[model samples]
Target: MGKQLGFYYNSNYCIGCQACETACKNKNKLPVGIHWRQVDHFETKNENNDRQVDRYISRSCMHCKQPACAAVCPVKAFRKRPEDGIVVQDREKCIGCRACVHACPYKAVAFSNQAVKASKCDLCIDELRQGEEPACVRGCPLQVLKAGDLREMEVKGVVKECQGFLKAATGPSIRFAPEKR
Candidate 1:
């Protein structure tokens, strides 16, 4: 790909308000029960400190560098944009085989039971083209979400993977900032 655009998420500042999730649904007009983006919550209380801890992992398609979805799609319905490296799905070409759904480690490829097709994030391609940020990024009230060049978004010393997310061989294009205190 020419340039890989990806997301930067700071779990520390994410309050799990789900505004990002709502914005994504509203912007994409997705089928009912199909979420292009979702927030996963993790909570705990420090045993010694007794301090409550909550972290929200707001995520969607990783838009992997080597997408297993693309490799396994029977109808060649998926393509990574050469210019920006955003993974895209051609719904018309989909066969409802669910192969992509099975192959994605991130659980990003959602099968729409209503539509009998697979759907995932396209990085808000149209909005990006219009020079607007993705709805999820813009919807975050705490400014915890951002999208940009993968390399540029990476934190200098923080781990790319989070509690529930892994750094797969697919080379997921997401970066995570250290959780804020």
Candidate 2:
């Protein structure tokens, strides 16, 4: 699982409850309006059924193969770990320049108005080191999120991008379970 650890979200089954978001906040103790992960919901026409369906999206840092956040950070505060390909932020090095926030194509990086630093999902590296799944994966009531080797997950018929998510040049590390009819 060391080549590229990434996240897979099955949007078809997600209920948009923000349980993952809450769990992340609880685990990271993030201040108000600072989100390491976020949920977005919308209504779309189900082409198969010709009826409207609610679509819920849960996303965090893509931990991209070529992360723009890391590229744009003047302090080099963002880096992708060589062992697992998890993009990590060195907060101590951050200067709150917000370049990463603007450069990230996935919009994964977050700037805290309170702390004035940039932060994003690190995929709960401490938990991974202890052999536990990320807090968001553990916290989802519907069990829609999974994290592991990116290559292995790609073999499971996942798509590189979900609705409303663009395929950027950064090669986002996230995949999505195919939508169900």
Residue-wise lDDT of candidate 1 within 100-148, one digit each (tens)? Answer: 9999988999998878899999999999999999999998899988999
Residue range 50-167, candidate 2, lDDT tens digits: 8889898888898898999988888899889998898999999999999999998767788988788999999999999899999999999999999999888887678987786767
Give the local distance difference test score of model 1.
Answer: 0.88
Off by over 4 Å in 2: none
Quote model 2's TM-score: 0.95
Give the TM-score of each candidate: 0.93, 0.95
- Report the C-alpha displacement of residue 3, candidate 1, in angstroms: 1.4
Candidate 1: clashing pairs of residues:
none
